[model samples]
Target chain A: MSTGPYNYSYIFKYIIIGDMGVGKSCLLHQFTEKKFMADCPHTIGVEFGTRIIEVSGQKIKLQIWDTAGQERFRAVTRSYYRGAAGALMVYDITRRSTYNHLSSWLTDTRNLTNPSTVIFLIGNKCDLEGQRDVTYEEASKFAEENGLLFVEASAKTGDNVEEAFLETAKKIYQSIQDGRLDLNAAESGVQHKPSQPGRNNLSNDQQANKDNCAC
Target chain B: MACLWSNSNEVLIQIPLTEEIDNVTFYQISVKVGEIKWNVKHRYSEFYNLHNQLITDHGVSKDILPSKKVIGNKSEPFIENRRKALEKYVQKIFIFLRQTMPKIFVDFLDFHLYDIYFLLQDLSLLCFTKGDLILSSSRVYSFKPIELYAINEFLKSPAPNFTNSSKQLDLGPILDLCSQLDAFIIHGCYNDYLKSNIILNKLPIDLSPFKIQKGLYLSNVSLDMVTSLGNARETVTTLEVVFSNVKRISDILQCDILHKNTLEESQKWKVLETLDLSNNNLMDIDESINLAKNLKHLILDNNYISTVSDLTQLPNLENLSIENNLITVCNDLHRKIGNIKTLNLSLNNIVTGKGFYKLYSLETLNLSSNKITNIEELECLGRLPCLEYLVLNGNNVSSSIDYRVKVLEFFGERAADIYLDNEKPSEAELDKVSILSALRIVKEGKTPDLSMNGSS
Candidate 1:
C-alpha cells in the first residue's frame, strides 16, 4: 500500500449515464479493469469504480460512478449529476429507444451538473454489429448539436474504452490548465496531491477491487 | 408713412445677435429709421459682405432658393387643405423640437432649419395618441420611427397598461403571446431575487398545487401556498417533482385533507398512477404502499429498504425494482402480490438459490453481480411459467458453454432465455433430449420433466 495519504496529484469524479442496457457499466468496467465482464449484472442504483492513470507525468485518479439506466432510476441518479467533473452519457448501438431518450437525459445532465463539467457521449455495444439500431451519423449529429464529445466503443472487445476515459481526463486537465475549472472550488471535483513514495501501490489495490467488480 | 410703418415693425424685428446677421443676409432687410441707436456695429454692407463670404466658403454657385413643388394638383380645395394641414403639422413639430433642443444647438438648428421641414413631412403620415406617446417615451428611451405603428395600435386600445392588464384582462392574449414566444407560463411566486416579480399571481384562485400541463415543471413549492386546481388536475396527468427535498409524501397528499368533505375524494388520489419517489429519505415502504393504490410502476431503487414485504399489498403493481437494498435471500420475493413482469434484484447480497424459487410470474429477473457460482441454483426458477429474460451477467456460472446450456435447460420447455455472456446455445446443446423436453413443456405450458433431466 502507498504510505502517502494522497496517491495522485488530482482526483476527478466522473459519472456514466445512459438508457437501460446501454453498457454504461460495461464501459466503466472495461476502462478500469482492462477486460470484459461477461456476466456483469445490470447496475442497480449507482456503482463506484476508481483507476489511477498518468497524464503528462501527473498521477490522476478517476473516481467514476455508474448508475442504473432505467427511466425510473433517474430520480435517484439525478442527484449524482451534481459536482461531476466529467459525465459519460452512453447509449446502446443496438437499441433505438435508448438512443431516443438522449435528449431528456441531456436535459437532466445540463440542468443538474455545473457549467464546467465535461459531458462525453458514448455509443456502447458496438461489438454487436448485427443488432445495430441507431446509426453513427445521427448520434454524432446529436452530440454535435449539444456541444458534447462523442465516440462509439465496445466494452466486450475492450475497444476504445480507454480512449473514452483518457479523452475525458485530458479535456478536464486542459480545463484545469486553462483555468476554466477552478481547482480550489469545493465542487470542482479535482484535487491536487503532493508526490510521495509507495502511493502507487495503494492505487493498485483500489484498481484491483475495481477489476473484481468491473461490470 | 415710412416712419409710422418703421415704428410698428420695430416690435416685430426681435432677433438675437446671432440670428440678426443671418436674417440681414438672407432677407436683405432695411434698417428701421425711428429705432433707438446703440454702439453695436450694425452695417448693412457688412451683412451682405458676410453673406458673399459665406456663399464663397460653402461653395454655393447659384443665389436662388430651392423650388417648393406641390405633390399633387393644388387647384382643388381638398388638396389645398391637405397641403396647408401638412405645413401646420411641420411648423408644430419645429416648435416642439425648438422647445426640447439644448440652448447651444438653437443656432445650429436655425442654420439647418430646412432639415426639420423634411422630418415633419414624414411625421405627418403617422397617427399619435396620448397613450402611444406615454408608452413610447417610457419604453424606447430614444425616439425612433420603428415603434410608431406598435405604439399607435397600443394607444388605440381602451386599456393601455400592459403590465397590470392581467388582473382585469382575459388570459387568452397572454397565453397566445407565451405560445408565440415558446415561453413557459409560471403561475406562482419565484423565490429568487432576480426572478421575484417576473411571474405574477393575480388569478382569482391559486393554481400552485395544480399540476401544470405535460412537460411543465414546478419546483421549490410548498403544499399550503396552493388553494384550488380547478380542472388542471384532471387535464395534466404526468407530474415530476425532483430536487424539491420532498422527504414526506404528506406534502402532495394534502389534497386528501382539502377534499375531506367531498363525495368523490378518493378519486383524486387514484388519478396519479405513476409515482416517482426514488431519492427521498424513505426508510420503509409503508407510506408508499398505503397511498399508491393505483400505482402500476413503483421505483424504490436507492432507498434503505431491507425486505420485499411492503410490496405484497399493491394489487396492480407490474414493474417492481428494489435494486440496491439489503435483500440477501430470494425467498423474500416469493410472496409478491401482483404478477410482476420485471423484478430487478441486481445489486443485492443474495448468494444462494433459495430465494429464486418464490417469484412465479416474473418475466425478467436480474440476478447479475451476485455471489452465486454454480448454475444449479437457478434451476429453482423452472417453476416461473412466464420467466423469459434472465440476466446473469456478473455471476460465476460455469465457464463452459455446455455447462451454461445444462443449467439453462433445467427450466425445461419454459426455460427462461438466459443472458450469461456474449454466447448463445449451440445446435448440440439445443438438440439435447432434456432441452427438447423442456421446450415441449414451454410450448404445452406444463411443468418440466424432472425424471428425464439429470440432477445437478
Candidate 2:
C-alpha cells in the first residue's frame, strides 16, 4: 500500500537537542508548523513532530523528536538520542552561557547517537543582532575544528532553518547512495520503504519494506 | 573522545575464538573502531601473506608474528597460540604503520568497506592527473565524521606532507593522514597551507543553497473547518494541521472534498492514515475522527480536553499520544482507547491505575511528569499482561526510597519484564524482587517453591 504515487520512500529519525530555552521546540515549530511560537511552553518531556522532506530526488519522511532541553530532564532526553540519523544541536547566539555548554552537549551526542549520525550546530536567535553574544566566525571555527555542519538560523525569522534540516538529510541520503550507511544495521537510524510504482530499480538505498507487502 | 560507549578511533582487534574449516583454522578478527564493529576471518596463510607484504612492500621489518609451524599447526594448542600472536601482529601493523598505513594492511582490516574508498580513489586519481593548481577546497570528500578524526592523525603524522599519493585510491595515505580530506587540501597543504594554515583550518561548506524542500508543509496559517483538512491533496496520506480553531472533529469533516456524498458517508478518509491535531482548543473527543477507520496514529497532545472519551470509533488506532491534556481521572480509559499498543499520557492529572485495567496489548506506556503520589497506584498496573515499559519520572512516588524496588516487587516473577521509568530492573533490584516474593510466600504460610532453598 506504500506504493502510492507520492508516499515517502524513507523515514529518517532525527533528534533536536540543546540547552534549555535555546529554541529547540521553537525550531521544530518553525520547521514543521511554519510559524514561530512566541509562547512555546518549556517542554515537559519528549515531543514528536515529523515533516516529509526531499533530498537528491528522493522523498524522505523526517521523524523529528524534540526533547526537553532542561538539565534535569537529561535522563529522559538521553534515551531519545539513540537511533537518530541527524542531531540538531542548538545554542542561543545571544547567550554566551548557552554557547559554553556546547562541549557538554557534543559529548552526549557523540556518545549516545551512532557514529554516522550527522550533527548540525545551529546558533538560534540570529535575528537578535543587538544582543549578539556569540560571534559567527568563532562558532564557524568551532564547527570546522569539530566535525559538524554549522548554521546560524533564527526560528522566529525562519532563516536558514530549512537548509539546516535539509542539508543533514542530503548528506545522509548521499551516505545511503554511496553505501556508507547500511540499512540492515539496527543503529543506522533509517528505514527503507517500497518506492512508488515504476520508480526504477530496487537497488541503491531503495529496498522493499520489511513486511514485503507490495500493496 | 570522552564518550562512554565508543572509544575514539581506537582499533580493538579481539580474537575471542577461532573456526576450523576443511582442516584449515580461521581466526576471527572481531574489529571495533570507535562506534563501528565488524568481523573478518582469516586463515594462517592469509596472515602470513599480510605479514610478508607488510615487510616487503611497506618496509615493515618488525616481523614479530608467531613463527609459522607448518606441522601440527592445526592442532588445538597451536591454533590457540597463533590466535594470540596473530592478534598482536594485526595490532602492531595498526600501531606501527598508522601514519603511512599501506593499502595492503588497510585492506586486511576492512577499513575501506564503504564507497568512501572508491570515491577517495577517484579524487586521488584526479589530483594525480591534474597539476596542483586548484585548492583542495574546490572538491569535497563524502565522509564528515572521519574528517574530524583525521585531524588528530594529520597533526600527529611526523610527515604531514603527503603529496599526490597517485598510487591509486590513496586509501593508505588518505586514511592514514586521517582519511577523507579534501585531496586538494592535503596536497595543497603539502605545498602551501601546511606551513601557513592554522591547526583548526578545515574546509567549510556553505549549506544555505541546500535548502531541503520536498513535501508540502502547511505554511503560517490558522486552520478552519474549510481550509484545514479540506484543502489536503487528494493523494496526501499524512496531515499535520495544528494551531487551529473550530471545536469537534466533525467540523474538519465539513470540507467538501473530505465528505463524498455526505459527511458521514465519506470514503475520503480511506487514504488518510496519520493526523496530528496538537495545540488545539477542543472540548470534546468527537466520534467523527473514527470516520477514517484506517487512521492508525493520532496525536492530540496539548489540548484542553478533560477525558479520554469518544475514541472508540477508531478501529485501527494503534498509537496515540495525548500528552498534555486536562484529564484528571482515567477510570474508563481502556473502554475507550483499549487495544492500542502504544500510549502516551505524560503530564496529565491521572490519580489511579485502575483505568489501565484491561489494556492487554499495551506494551509501552509513558506516564512521566504526572501527579500520582501513592505507591499503591502502581498495583493496578499488575493486571495488564503485556505492560512492559512503564515510565514514571517526575512523579512523587519515584522520589520515595526503594521506589524502583517497590514497583518491581509488584510484578513478582515478571519483575524482569517491566521497565520502570524507561529502565529495566537491574540485577540487584531483580534479586530484591525475588526475595520479596519469597518473603510474601513465607508470611502467607505457603510452601516455598522448589527454586528456593526453603524446605517444604
Candidate 3:
C-alpha cells in the first residue's frame, strides 16, 4: 500500500481576514498560484485554497480560507476563525480605514479562535507605493502591541507573499517543535502524525497520535 | 484565550423564572457556569405542571418544589421570596434530572417557548457547497433564515444526508453557519441554544479521508508528497522532479529518466512545474523548456550552468535558483528572466552586477558568496523598482567600509525598508545610515573637486 501524496504530517487550518479590498483573497491566490489576479472578484462568504510548503525540512499543508472583508460578512466569517492554526489579518496599505479596523478584527479573532492561533498581520498592496497610506512603522507597532507576526506584502508583485504564508507555517512548526501548542486540544488546529519506520524524533507528537488512535 | 470549548465543569444551577399574570407567577433566572450563561424564564403553572407530571410519572417528591403562597401573592417581597424559592427548587430538580434524565432534561432546558420562526423560502437560492452563503446575527433580534435553516436541516433533522447521490457535501459552509450561531448564543442572546455542538462533532466526519475511521491514520505518507498533492493533484499536474546526470536537457524533459516511453505518455512533462535539475552536468538550457509552459519555479542549483542562456522562453518562470553554479559574469540574466522575482545565484563566480540591470521587477535577489568587490557593482540594482529584499553576504562589498549605509544609499528610499540577511534595518539604524551616507557622499565629492583645483 503506497501512502501516496495525502501523507502530510499535519494539516494546519488558516483564516485570512481584513477589511474589503485588502487583498485577502488575492494573497491566497498569489501564494497558491504564484500569479497576480488583478481583476479578482471580492469573496462573498469564504474561499478555500491549499498549498503544501516545506519549513525546517518538514512539509506542511496549509488549508487556507480566504474570508470576505465586508462588515456584514463577519457573521459568516467568524465561524471560520475557530481552530485556525494561523490567522492572517490583512489590511490595505493604501487605505487607513482598513488599518483602523484592525482592533475590531483582532478582537473578533481573539474572542472566537483559540489562543494558539498564529495571528499574522499583513500590510497588503505594498506595490502600490504611490497610493500608500499606512506606514510600515505603525503597522509593525500595532502587531507588536497585539502580539502578532507582522509583514508588508504585495499580492500583485508577489513581494513577501510567500514569506507571509511560509513564516506563519514556520512559526506553527516551531510551536510543534516546542510543546507550546497542545496537539491533543481539539481546537489547537494541529494533528499529530503516527510514527513510521523512517520517522524522526524531532516531532514529539508520536506518542500523542498513538494515544488518540486508541480512542 | 481558552479554546472554543473550556473544561470548567459547568452545570446549570438556578434558573430564575421571570413574568407573572392572573394564575401564572413568572420566574426569570440567569444561570452562569463559567463562560456559558443561560437566561431562562418560566411561569408558575409551567413548573407546577412539570412538578405534577414528575409526581405522576416518576413518582418524584413534591417536597423540593416551592409551594405557591396565597397571602400577599402580588406583593414585591412575596414575589421576591417566591423567585428565590423557585430557583432553589429548579436547581434541585436539575440535580435530580442530571442523575436520572440527563439527555432529555438537558434537551428540554435548551428550548424556549417564545419561538421566532423564520422562512426558509430562499433555501433553493442558497448554494451551500459554492460558499456563496452569508449569514449575520448583528441585526439585533432580526430573524436569520440561514441559521434557522441549518438548525432545521442538519441539527434538527433525524438523520441528515450531508451528501448527494455521488459526492459528499462540503462542511465549510455548514460550519460557518454553526459557528455564527454559536457566537451569537455566547455573546448576543444567551437565550437560544445554538445547535453548534452537533455540527462541531459531526462535521469532521466529512473531513475523514478514510470514510469515518474514528482513528484515521495521520502522517501515513511522506510529508513531501502530501504538500505535493496540495499543489498538483495526482491526476492533473506534476509537482516535483528529481533526476541527475542528463547528457542532454531533453533526456530529462522527455521523462526518459523517470519513465521509458515518453511519446506514449499523454502527460509527458506537460504538467511538470517544479524541475529540480540539481547536481547535474548541465551547461546551458537553450529554450527547449517551452514544453512545460506552466513552469513557475525551476531549480538548477549545484549545476555547471555557467550562463542561463534562454530562460525567457518559459513565460511563467518566476523563481530560478541556480546557486553553486560556475557563472563568472551574469550578462543578460534580467533579459532572459523578465518575470523572475527570486533569483538565488549564491556560491557563484559572479564578479559584476551587469546582468541584473534590466531586472526591474526583482523583489528578492540572493548573490551571496560572490566576488562582488565594489559598491558601484550593485548600483545596477537601484533600477529595480520593486527590489525589497536582497542578500549579498560573503561578497567583498559586504565587508567594505559602511557597507550597510552604502547599500541603503544605493537603493535610496527602499534601503531602510528592504530586508538584508532576513532583517529589516531598524529605524535608528536607518537614520544613522542616512546621516553617514550623506556625510560620506559630500566628503568624497568635495575632496575630489579640491584635488582637481590644486592640480590645475
lDDT winner: 2
**What local distance difference test score does each model get?**
0.54, 0.66, 0.61
Residues A1-215 of candidate 1: C-alpha lDDT, one tens digit per residue = 11222345677888899888888888887877777888878665566666777776666878787877876556546655655799999999998998999998898888767889999999998989999999999999999999999999999998888888989998998787767888778567676643355444344332342342233
The root-mean-square deviation over C-alpha atoms between each candidate and the true structure, in angstroms, is 27.8, 28.0, 29.2
* Cα error of candidate 1 at position B247, Å: 14
DockQ of each: 0.01, 0.01, 0.01
Q: Please give the lDDT score at residue A139 for candidate 2.
A: 98
Between prediction 1 and prediction 3, which has the larger lDDT? 3
Question: Which stretches of model 1 miss by more than 4 angstroms?
Answer: A4-6, A193-215, B1-456
Residues B192-219 of candidate 1 have per-residue lDDT tens digits of 2121111112212244322344322333
lDDT of 3 by residue, B1-456 (tens): 001112124655574455776666667655554444555556766777778877766557967778866677878787788788878887777666533432224334542211111112122224253323344433111223223323344433343231122222234444444333312110112123343222211211112121111111111112211111211212223333233254445544543234433433333445555666566667886444655655667877877888777664454566789899898977756445544567899999988777787564467899999999989888888656557788988999899987776776666544655787677877766787667656776878854222111111
Tell me the deviation in Å of residue B339 in model 2. 1.9
Positional deviation of B273 in candidate 2, in angstroms? Answer: 1.7
- Residue clash pairs of candidate 2: A1-A215, B121-B169, B136-B184, B136-B185, B150-B178
